[model samples]
Target: MKKLLLVLAALLVAACAHAPAQSAKEAGAKTERNFSPAHVKEVIVKGKTTQKEILAKIGTPNSVKRRSLGVTTGPAEVWNYWTAPPLNDVAKGGLQPVTSLAVVFDDNGVVQDYAAADSSVLIQ
Candidate 1:
């Protein structure tokens, strides 16, 4: 029984070794989505856009958090939508592209500020 298990494990490893590697474009495709940073920014208007508008344009966020903006501003709500490389790809080493959007809203539920980032390009 032990020998049979060992043979099966060895075969599995051999198969994996012969598997073709994923192309760079294929890796990026894994993280790419319908919406992008520019799309999010276009849909959102700081101090003008409301939470409902954001939901209508971009759909639900991946996460929501509440925190203090400053001593004067008190608290605010933040919505984040993130698309990052898979953990398995990162585990293999090297930088992986990440695209995300964060929207901050005041107590009135109107967008106060927003930022988007894409790590596909490196700045000089």
Candidate 2:
């Protein structure tokens, strides 16, 4: 009986250790609004997009900011999105993951530049 119990416990531990990590897709499926990393990457890396195009593609940004009213500067737009950390690290006290997508547009409303920032330490 002791040996059988030990074997079952070992198997349970091994099974959990080898389980696949939960991705953002799995967690976000339960929410009303969810944007995957791939979706965010597509817009930021693609060329010459507009505000309407962005909204149609990635939904509304989490937040938006405009340049100072009087300052003469190129018009720009920024978008922010966040995802929960993978399950493997959540129990280990990992930081909640976030992704920021910034799309800068010229005064004429043409995509001038774009950037994506991730909270993963490995990315930096």
Question: CA lDDT, every prediction?
Answer: 0.66, 0.55
Which candidate number would show the highest TM-score if scored against the true structure?
1
> Which candidate achieves the best lDDT against the true structure?
1
Q: For residues 71-113, write the lDDT of model 1, one tens digit per residue.
A: 4464378888765454354344455676778888988899988
| Alpha-carbon shift of residue 15 in model 2 (angstroms) | 39
Candidate 2 Cα errors over 4 Å, as ranges = 1-41, 44-47, 84-92, 121-124
Deviation in angstroms for 51 in model 2? 0.5
Tell me model 1's lDDT, rounded to 2 decimals: 0.66
TM-scores of all models?
Answer: 0.56, 0.49
lDDT of 2 by residue, 1-124 (tens): 5434444554564454442455798546533433545665665444567777776566555555666778777565554443444434443443456565666666656667766666652211
Error of 2 at 33 (Å): 6.4
Looking at model 1, which ten-residue stretch has the lowest summed lDDT?
10-19
- CA shift at 104, candidate 1, in angstroms? 0.6
Write down the TM-score for model 1.
Answer: 0.56
